[model samples]
Target: MTSLSTSKLLALLALFVWQAHASLANSPRSLPARDEFVCPAEDIANTGCLGPKDCLYANPNNCNTFIRCIANADGTGTPVVLPCLLELEWNDNKKECDFPENSTCPPK
Candidate 1:
């Protein structure tokens, strides 16, 4: 058997995963209707990340505000409070600022 270098092995694995994702994405049955989407049940208020990645969390107290946690080099997240534009609110399901009518959170 031929010995493959670590980089070459990782590249092959990445290619395989990418191809599988592409095929699944192109499959018609892989996606659900937008209306059928469900949001996670965990309350995300005042959340922060302990890893090296930024995180977005929903503010359960106010639909019009959301928390954007910025990742720091020390493996901590800094939470920033952000407000939605006029007539909009934070949509936890979609993870973005959205129209109030389209928001999944209860009325504030």
Candidate 2:
């Protein structure tokens, strides 16, 4: 092949490799799961603000734990509300809802 044609081919091949790598890297590792928790209506309304597909839950520990639903950003499928645990002051130590054992919060 001519030198010009060879260069074009190489460029196209490089572009393909880069695109493939990016796609693989950006692919979701796994489907996001949902967690269940209970908070007062006022707390829920104030704490975790609802987003397009996810809900923000207040993290008791960091003040950033927001429970969100797992779904594509495009908003498809049944939205599942995920439970997030926050750290609250317990005596002198920070306390959070334990997993499996204390997965769901008690009724308010």
Maximum-lDDT candidate: 1
Best by TM-score: 1
How far off is residue 20 in model 2, in Å?
0.3
Worst 10 residues of 2 by lDDT: 88-97
* Candidate 1 segments whose C-alpha is farther than 4 A from its true place: 1-54
What's the TM-score of every candidate structure?
0.47, 0.28
lDDT tens digits by residue: candidate 2, 1-108:
999999999999999977864564344232243223433344334434344322333333322233332333333322222223233211112232244333343323
Error of 1 at 101 (Å): 1.8
The TM-score, computed over Cα atoms with residue i paired to residue i, of candidate 2 is 0.28
lDDT of 1 by residue, 14-70 (tens): 999778645642332211232332222232233334332226657655677666555
C-alpha local distance difference test of each model: 0.56, 0.38
User: Candidate 1 — which pairs collide?
Assistant: none
lDDT of model 2 at residue 100? 34
Assess the local accuracy of residue 64 in candidate 1 as a C-alpha lDDT between 0 and 100. Answer: 73
